[model samples]
Target: MSEATTHQIPGLKQKKVFKIIVLGDSGVGKTCLTYRFCEGQFLDKSEATIGVDFRERNIKIGHEDIKLQLWDTAGQERFRKSMVQHYYRNVHAVVIVYDVTKPETFHSIASWMQEVESHGLMRAPRVLVGNKCDCGTPESRLATTYAQRLADKYGMPLFETSALLDSECDNVESIFMTLAHKLYSKQPLRVVSVEGELGPGVVTLGRQKRSASSNDSCLCS
Candidate 1:
């Protein structure tokens, strides 16, 4: 795991941090998708998330060094209202992930969306991701047509990704980059790069009642 240099970058003059939450049901490969994008590797037989794990990375979009706080919340149904509630604070964008091979996971998007919306981030930019495209046969893959329909219904951009294949890494990264651009283009967010900042790949979790560190907050002026 790469140590986060987000807080350690010298001469980080201007920076903005955007909070993005990944939502889905259990066993949908949410964690794998996150690790693939942040660390560029896949975890096999990974245990489910206990609470939430977030990674911070600063990606330059045009002239802006935007620090992205990617929060990978536990997709277990039990965490939706209670655990997810504490972490959703200041979320700027949300990515609802579903497994392409699991119809039930895809179906849970609506419920997940509802939980997120109720948390006062309804105006945040939302994206629908169908993950784990590398799994299952073509016949078992969730229909892109149906996924697109759902995306349209929610007015969220839809993306299908595979983390196991190295070639698809760009596709996965683009999802966050695109939203960062969209978010920056919408408003000039106020985030000052601070000393002692952490890197994006840093993972923070708990066995229960978990929340991301306050350092992830973007102090918008």
Candidate 2:
């Protein structure tokens, strides 16, 4: 990482901005994962995302202030095209999530990665996340060994986490914080970019909701 001079968004003081797109099959808890990270609480219920939902949070990593913009994409096939065309631009990282209890959803990880690579984003910092660990029975859950093998196939790290547990918030925090630090460490500072309204085919059900603040220690190495 270069200690080079950084630029800023017009009204913001963040030293860097990282765009992370969250992808997974429907009902895999993609929205809840982001809600937990941004709000520090589990979201009890949420509507299925139509095309995409945008959420953001500001955090201080060491002495540097950074903003993380998360794009939660809809999992349904019909909506995937517009999302791929519009939201995949300028993404710094990718989080491909799956439900621990549903093996079909887990199986869909290959397709999600194919979508990412289809957009020529094969080299972006990507991680595999198995969500909803708290709601599954041992007999019903997919083995972590399998998830690890798949992650290994892609040469990315795998993290198994639960969005519904307050006790597991640190695990949730570590997922994104790890990505932020990785992106910040390896990339050069670029001007903060903003997203315009999704025009034409895309459905934008949720506006961007900003997190309150970030006054905490780095949870990942």
TM-score of 1: 0.77
Query: Against the hidden true structure, what lDDT does model 1 obtain?
Result: 0.77
> What is the C-alpha lDDT profile of model 2 across 9-62, one tens digit per residue?
245444578899999999999999999999999899887888889999999877
Candidate 1: segments with Cα more than 4 A from true spot: 1-13, 189-221
Give the TM-score of each candidate: 0.77, 0.80
lDDT of 1 by residue, 103-145 (tens): 9989888888888778866677898999889889989999899
* Candidate 1 collision pairs: 4-199, 7-197, 55-200, 56-200, 57-200
lDDT of 1 at 98: 89
Model 1 superposed RMSD (Cα): 12.1
Per candidate, the number of residue pairs that clash is 5, 0
